[model samples]
Target: MKVLTANRLSDGIAVWYADGGWAETVTRADIAHDKAAEDRLEAIGAAAAANNEVVDVN
Candidate 1:
């Protein structure tokens, strides 16, 4: 249930993290078990933000 969520930077489309990237479906969600795991996921989100690939990920 703990998966990263964000809006695509290009058009602000809703998105989620799956496998090693962002996806358009919850079915592709990358679940996180704990804070540490979430932090790892956060790293990906941060990278996306820095690259202008996503925004407000959590």
Candidate 2:
């Protein structure tokens, strides 16, 4: 399983990280900035922030 953390960029894009390494960078345009996607990411961020662990789902 791969753990990932997403950081929202100033340009409104999200950059993905895994184990403190860069995984990928996704823009809002890439996901169409949908509510579902935003909510999902927010949930992951919240979990990560609370536990100080990357969220992994595989």
Candidate 3:
């Protein structure tokens, strides 16, 4: 399984990709159970980084 994560650019808060936005907790984080899902999450993370919404995406 995999979860997209990053720190908020404004306050450096740890966040996880949930639904269609960043969440402060992992309980509701979007889980990637396959390669395709993982790829989608990675793309979201990359876009977030490019928009300066988050950093340290993983």
Best by lDDT: 3
Candidate 3 wrongly placed segments (more than 4 Å): none
Tell me which of candidates 2 and 3 scores higher on lDDT.
Answer: 3
TM-scores for every predicted model: 0.87, 0.39, 0.99
| Candidate 1 per-residue C-alpha lDDT over 14-46 given as tens digits, one digit per residue, 9 for 90 to 100 | 999998888999888999999988888989999
Model 2 CA lDDT for position 51? 68
> In model 1, what is the error at residue 52, expressed in angstroms?
0.5
TM-score of 3: 0.99
Off by over 4 Å in 1: none
lDDT of 3 by residue, 2-55 (tens): 999999999999999998999999999999999999999999999999999999
Worst 10 residues of 2 by lDDT: 23-32
Q: Ranking under TM-score, best-scoring first?
A: 3, 1, 2
* Candidate 3 CA-lDDT value: 0.99
Name the better of 1 and 2 by lDDT. Answer: 1
Look at candidate 2 and tell me the lDDT of residue 30: 28
